[model samples]
Target: MTHTPLLKPVWLSMTLLLVWLLSACQRETDLVEPTTNTTVSNTAENETINKWILENMRDYYYWNDKIPASPDLTLAPSDFFDSLLYTYSATAAPDGDRFSWIEENADDLSASLSGESTTTGLEFMLYLRSQGSTDVIAQVLYVLPNSPAARAGFKRGDIISKVNGQPITTTNYASLLYSGATNYSFGLAEVQNSALVDTDKTLSVTATVFQANPVFLDSIYTAGTKTVGYLVYNQFVPAPNNSSGTEYDDQVDAIFSNFKARGVNELILDLRYNPGGYTSSSANLASLIGKNISTSSVYFREEWNSTLTPYIKQEYGDEFFVQRFLNKSQNIGGNLQRVFVLTTDGTASSSELIINGLRPYMTVTTIGTTTYGKNVGSITIVDDSGKIKWGMQPIVFKSFNSQGQSDYSAGFAPSIEVQEPLVLKPLGDITEPLLNEALYQITGNRLARRAVATGHSLPALGSSIQRKAGGGRMIKSLTAFKTAKLPQ
Candidate 1:
């Protein structure tokens, strides 16, 4: 009993220790039994954040108010949003719980649809430049070669007035041209006779749309003593339907076969503004001209964050090149060599693919200014809602060249960069200086002689289309090389 009696100092110390122990025990108890409502609120907060993200994407393009976009999105939608213009920006989500819907399928939704938007007009149409001459039109793209329109004798510079049973008025022309008539084939319409009885008169006529062989023909030039061939490939896009009617690929194959047969000393394939088409077609052309070819382990491919919501990877393929490409893989090939390409800012997509594919094997000499750098692409898919969603905000996966360098964004620089020559041509005539330069390199009586004297053959280009000792008369057009300027 006496020992149990504690001093006042000891009692105080013991009391403090007990109080500290009690406080520690209380902390543990609280930790073991979290309030159910508190946990639920936390989960709700996370869901709210995700909801905010989805809302943001859905409402990014609303006019009056910023449509509330969803917030639970991964990094892709945001990146996609920044890349598009106001006219093309899109944010779509399901009517209910938009967050979960997008979270589950946003990646694909952003990429699959084509023509997300048009800035200046409602649809896509070719814009032409008037090259000053009353007879020549400028800024016109060659949609088909030897087609009814071209063969019906519609020259490159001919101004089209109307299509089948319609006046080529501005109100309907854009839409009409984009929605061209298969009936016209390759033909173009012009303003018919101005009769007092008929106020607006335009008539549709058949043009030449025929089976033309791809031949360099004897259009080669010889300056001092060299032989040079000049050929034009206006477009490379395949037809929607045809054995070879509108397919750029068949044209390419024909061109290569002609090239192989023609025993060319030197050649010029005029692609000046050949707005690129066909992925495999371009590759085929490159391989034909290329000496060493290597297949890519990966092409332009992209990978999205898998953990965030419902993320999916983008697979860029021959088809997706028209869309923005995502991730791509390549296979090694048997050949590798040099390639000579003439290009411009108009050279895009599948056109660039040719350059990229040929870089590893051939001595790539780009003869134009910097190309349009649109590396990323997307895919289109109809979701469970049956709504056509351009899902898979496809990203640039891999631009692995044979050399193991991916400078796709920079585009291939011209070894001999030249620009459009300031020539005195009418509105529709193009100013092609690069093509002439390539000709200058291969042709010229003096050049042919020099090559021969230098112990090189005058390009016994394999076929019978080789130029004779002296070539044809020089054509007086502004396809000159010396007059062009180079871009910085």
Candidate 2:
């Protein structure tokens, strides 16, 4: 892996990864100066780590002003990190922080943010076996191609009732599914006649370190005089294999290049499983779809805390806060009037940003369900000294579109609502529920519906156990801010 100088701290929305290189002479305090004194009790249990946490939180957290002046220093690092957040509660604090988190291993967190993790590549959702029962069933959403799960014949819509011969319940599912085991034997089941029928069939798979490519699928469908481009983009990663290059972003460009070359007019961006990643990639995507835009056209803007905001303004001027569209040769927005987005509860952060950012330029019609409401972002802080093993992802900024619209905290509701049915179809199949709807909207002719055996579909519990990272995030390089010399 190529390590940059500013790898110690990365600014992110919800799921963001950026490695920046800052000047060797620049001090960490140049951008964020710790408020608390350094003489706090270091001998207390976890005080040393907690003190470091407090200092960073005080400097960079979006709700920095709301944090208590003197917090409990004796709490564990994770607990202490939680105590400082202006937590979002449904009734108590509806507008508080909900995405900031701390992980024990910074390396693991970094790897996960970069789309690298150990897994069976089983993306799934959890559903209650019955309306009132605690028993849970795991439905395979979409297995990563060539993954262990795919090699084991786990396809979309496959159901898992048990793991290691033990029934999956609401209480034990997390530990049973994510037990860090090297291998697993899944007990299979099927939804027959609206009832879950357990079968004696079992399939076992092993977990291995895998790096997923965010560009899942892309194709073109021609109907009469209209041509549509369909892309299933699962994440916004700019690269693969922890490289500093923009390989993934370049692949997206190439996909659009093909779309534009093929005379495609209509577009369907599938972001149902995209949690969010690199903001730079998001801009790259939006630029390709935003009609009549240029490199100077404002794409989105960032709003940091009071301290860093004014400092950035003073150092780099107002333009520093704005991100502009990149001039790409493969832009297809010029040939399109509207774009359809496929979404779900899992769609978040940079995913939402794309929708919000493009609406001002074109017709952005969303399908499927409401998004995973997350408009704010965080900064990934790892101890450069290597003494503190924990990594802190603190919400450091809120994002807004070019028109200054940032009020989608409850998530953007779909214009045309459709849910993924209990019986799933393989993605990229034009007959799939979401894609079918998009094609119908474009061609004005709906495909013949397949009759179902029963009207009952699995109740969506919104619970899932998947090997993915970062939902609702945008990442920016701190090097942009560090390059501007700060006053001593």
Instruction: Please name the candidate that would achieve the greatest lDDT relative to the true structure.
Output: 2
Instruction: Write the residue-wise lDDT of candidate 2 on 1-488 in tens digits.
Output: 11233212433223431111111101111112233443345335377778878877766788988899889877666667878989877799887777777777777777777788888988888888888889989988889999999899999989999999999997888678866788899999997897789999999999999988889999899887788899999878888755879999999999999999999999999999887887888989999999989988888888888855766677689987788999999999889999999988778788888998998888999988888777877767777677777777888888888899998887889998888877788998877888888888888773424322222355655433223434455666553344332222
Q: Give the per-residue lDDT of model 1 (tens digit) for 246-293.
A: 354455555555444544345455554443333334444554555432
Name every residue pair that clashes in candidate 2.
Answer: 12-378, 13-377, 13-474, 14-473, 15-473, 348-472, 349-472
Q: Against the unseen true structure, what C-alpha lDDT does each candidate score?
A: 0.31, 0.76
| Model 1 residue-pair collision total | 102
TM-score of each predicted structure versus truth = 0.44, 0.89
TM-score of 2: 0.89
True-vs-predicted CA distance for residue 478, candidate 1, Å: 44
Name the lDDT value of residue 82 in candidate 1: 31
Error of 1 at 133 (Å): 18
